[model samples]
Target: MQRTLQPGQRCEVWIAGVTGESELVFTSDELLLEAPNWTLDGSALILNGDGKLWNFDVAGRTLSQVPLAGIPDLNNDHVLAPDGKQIFLSANDGHIYRAPLGGGAAERVTAVDGSFHFLHGVSPDGGELAYVGIDAGDFSQPGRLLTIPAGGGHSTLVDVGAGHCDGPEYSPDGKWLYLNTESFTSLPGHAQLARLRVDGTGFERLLDSETVDWFPHLSPDGDLASYIRFPHGTEGHPADLLVDVVLVSTGDWAAPLHTWPLFGGQGTLNVNSWSPDSARFAFVAYPLANTDSSKDHVRD
Candidate 1:
């Protein structure tokens, strides 16, 4: 099957039990909706598409656009505030903004020129935001894990050293920051999942294997961390590859508690998608068009 950017993408909301099978809560024909976050009240799932945000009702199976009037060019890096009252958005223009969760005009959060900032997670106290920032024109250099005041202030480099660091999510307890790091400019080296203190100390490598892991999302309870694993040697986080959503015990990252294989990557699990209870998550998977070259194949 050849994976085309056509309209075959299926956006799914799945609930994975701690000790049981995963169930699909919702599915739709809408394609390219990425990185969904559940509303705190658990009433709806919020996602981004076509440079705008969207809200999907879980019970009614209905979808509607979020009225972000003045903001455009939104990316998948947007995340909901810990309080669930605001949304942090990263635009293609390399700036970050925040808007009311209910839908309203967005306000600039970062005041930088020509710097790309990608939102990953907000602190549990709602005082700081964890993100990855890099030069807009430099793809060879790794992005630095950074933190700034939630209200907007000078950004602080997380001092994770050199690597393509991404997905800087904070633990529910606000004690540690978890993220993924790959070699700055090499393919032979594998991407590893890691965590460090918010003060830039206590760095530890949680998972290192043949698979390239990215975007580790800590459950609301802080007991589990779920992330998407790409095939070994995949240069970048490209879509349409055979990937797996691997869940690991936060206390013991030695082995994955469970692994669900799927036909999606990149857009899948780009941001934190854990439910309020932390038992379920939302992700996107694309169904490929059947063709001679696309026979249940996994891209490398």
Candidate 2:
């Protein structure tokens, strides 16, 4: 479901460290923003808000809209290209697009296939993209993982057990795709963190938990990871709910390095936000109108 913009809500964009330190960089009691992707040069973050994309300069602490001609409203599922000059965006129209990072006209990357593509990762070499395909735009059908050429080509279906999956992201080394899937259990909406070999073999869960985990994003160095944890029994990653932005070692996901309790759920950590050096990552929080979450707490 498309979550409408909450004009009365306060949108906060924060930068947090692996050591449990965090800083509020930009904020407004206005429209919504989601899925901030750090630039390769570490100068800024790109996020989608109010059905458009904006660039938040990290150093200047300012926000600016990214001008793209002829592109529809975008979803939170977007990934930066390995070249660092382009980005792949998933639009509300259920198609993926390629556009220059600075701002330019976008070119459609997906054919008129029967499925809607929600992009998550671009190969390290920038040759392919990984996304969850909802066949015929049917929400009741399980999402199938598919990889297509970055420039648009035939899609290859990846089997990840017969359950709905989201956030299929590629590792920096390009060997594995890390994501959340429900195949590990029969329970509905129970997404657990897992990884699959690029050849679609060796699928394994990173850790077992009752928490509904989604979107496992590894740092560029392959040492640290960040993901969103929804409350138990939550049907999906919905908006305006209490959740955790968790940081853990890629080697041991069972042990969390930091647990950030905040008021945002779905849009908070849906994409990779790690800085170029892996020292920091960005996330957004959408506090509900009735909640007093301004004094949110962080745990070590």
Candidate 2 lDDT (Cα, whole model)?
0.91
lDDT tens digits, residue span 1-300, model 1: 212356655655565666546666666554467778888988888887777788988778888888986665788888888778998988877778899989888898887656788888899988899888887647776788889898899988878867788889989899999988874335643678888998889988887677888888988998888889898887668887778888888888768887777777867788888779887777766655542212322222
Q: Candidate 1 local accuracy as lDDT? A: 0.78
- lDDT of all predictions, in order shown? 0.78, 0.91
RMSD of 1: 4.0
Total backbone clashes of model 2?
0
Model 2 TM-score, all chains together: 0.97
The number of clashing residue pairs in each candidate reads 2, 0
| Highest TM-score model number | 2
Model 1 weakest lDDT span, ten residues long: 291-300
